[model samples]
Target: MKNVVITGTSRGIGFELAKMFAKNDCRVLALSRNTKPLDDFNHKNITTISVDLSLAEDIKKAVSFVNSNWKKVDILVNNAGKLINKPFTELTSEDFLEVYKINVFAVAELTKNLIPFLQKESHVVTVSSMGGIQGSMKFPGLAAYSSAKGAVITLSELLAEEYKEQQIAFNVLALGAVQTEMLEEAFPGYKAPLSATEMADYIYNFALTGNKFYNGKVLQVSSSTP
Candidate 1:
């Protein structure tokens, strides 16, 4: 079975993705700030690690766990994210740093620590937002979140090129409005057209087959305009 390490598995897309991976017989190393919810899975293939991606120091435990338990990783999904819905004028510099800490820096740090453990044909997929992609529909009150996601997209492109010699693939999934708690928090009562389960299914398949044909590509996924 392929060994997979996924972050933000406590809920929403990350939770669904973990279940899908474990159901498919992949050994999953799930990391989250609060892992109590992960106990509901009770799947033998799933192992939960509690770590707050926003804190750089907390990421060490995740790296150590992976290093001690798994020699190689077939897939690494940087799916954990934090959203701060505040207008640019009201947003503080700390707001930007907090969002980037989770959405961008954590991904970079985790990937750096696990690069050696990535299998030769490993797939690395980072979740981003449509608002981050240039030319995509933009949303109000998402300055910090959008900018951090934009950074993630660019980081993936660079990593894909830098690690091409290792035959490792890196890609970003620029998702549209998915029906998750994060979306609801950002939009209040707005109902999104997509569901977390739906996105998880798409990501699972993409992690397995997408790298064969695409690298350093940002895929815009959504049914709506945004």
Candidate 2:
């Protein structure tokens, strides 16, 4: 069975993705700051780690788990994100850093630490945002969130190139409006065209097989203009 690592699994897409992988007979290590939700689910094939990606110690916990248990990771999904909605003028440096700490820095740190565990044909999929695309429609209060997402997209592209010889694929999914809590936080009352489970289904399939057809690419997984 494929060993999968997914971040931000407390709810929404991450949560659903964890269940999907486990149900499909894949071993999943689910990471989240609050592990209670996943702990309650208690699937035999799923393991939950309490990780606050902003902290180095917390990240080490995840790395330690992988080293101790699953020596190789077949798929790593950097699905954890942080979003702060405030006018650009009112946004402070701390605000930007907080968002980047979780959205950008954490992703890099986790992936870098896990590289040794990822073998040939391993897939690293990062969940980004449509707002990260340069020409995409921009929202009023997502300066920090959108910019951090864009940064990760570039990071994934660079990693894909750096690791191509090893046959590891890195790709970014710039998602559109998904009915996630994060989306609701960014755009209250806005109804998304897709549900978190629907999006998770797509991501689950891609993580298992997208590397064969694509790498170092950002796929825009959006049907609506947001």
Could you say which candidate leads in lDDT? 2
What is the Å distance of residue 10 in model 2 from its true position? Answer: 0.3
Every model's TM-score: 0.97, 0.99
Off by over 4 Å in 2: none
In order, what lDDT does every prediction score?
0.91, 0.96
Q: Write down the lDDT that model 2 would get.
A: 0.96
lDDT of 2 by residue, 177-217 (tens): 99999998999999999999999999999999999999999
Q: Give the Å shift of residue 30 in candidate 1.
A: 0.5
lDDT string, candidate 1, 6-92, tens digits: 999999999999999999999999999888887876999999988988776788787787788888899999999999998889999
**Could you say which candidate leads in TM-score?**
2
Point out the worst 10-residue segment of candidate 1 by lDDT.
54-63
